[model samples]
Target: MTTRNVRFVGGPLDGRVQDLRDHEAVAGRLLKHIHLHDGPKIETQYELHYTPENGWVYFLCGTQP
Candidate 1:
């Protein structure tokens, strides 16, 4: 059974975090979506902060200005 349902928000990964059983799976997905770029872009990198609250596993980061 899944440990819990993670709800992603405030970035490209604005959806429910799936595949909770696999660490690699979650990491891979986060890496892909968190960057906000689906394509292969080496420059696509940002600081991610895990701030789970109110039964939600979401994040908050500075947007591009």
Candidate 2:
């Protein structure tokens, strides 16, 4: 098994990157937070990138129209 890095781009959190063992947990928490602030209808995407060595990588969802 491998670990993953998180990266965000083209949004409010652009250029932000994070290294976490439980990125999925982090992502879930973030999504919940956004839902509370932005509501369930918010437009965004959470992108995940997979690596054989480092692990899964992801780009945090940036709100969009």
Please tell me which predicted candidate would have the highest TM-score against the true structure: 2
Choose the strongest candidate by lDDT.
2
Give the Å error, residue 35, model 1.
5.1
Model 2: residues with Cα > 4 Å off, grouped in runs:
1-4, 22-43, 51-56, 60-65
Q: Assess candidate 2 and give its TM-score to the true structure.
A: 0.37
lDDT of 1: 0.42
Error of 1 at 45 (Å): 7.9
Model 1: how far residue 16 lies from native, Å: 2.7
- Full-model lDDT for every candidate: 0.42, 0.51
Collision pairs in model 1: none
| Reference-based TM-score of each model | 0.37, 0.37
1-65: candidate 1 lDDT, tens digit per residue: 44555556655556646443434324323333334256543322223333444442545343433
Clashing pairs in 2: 3-54, 3-55
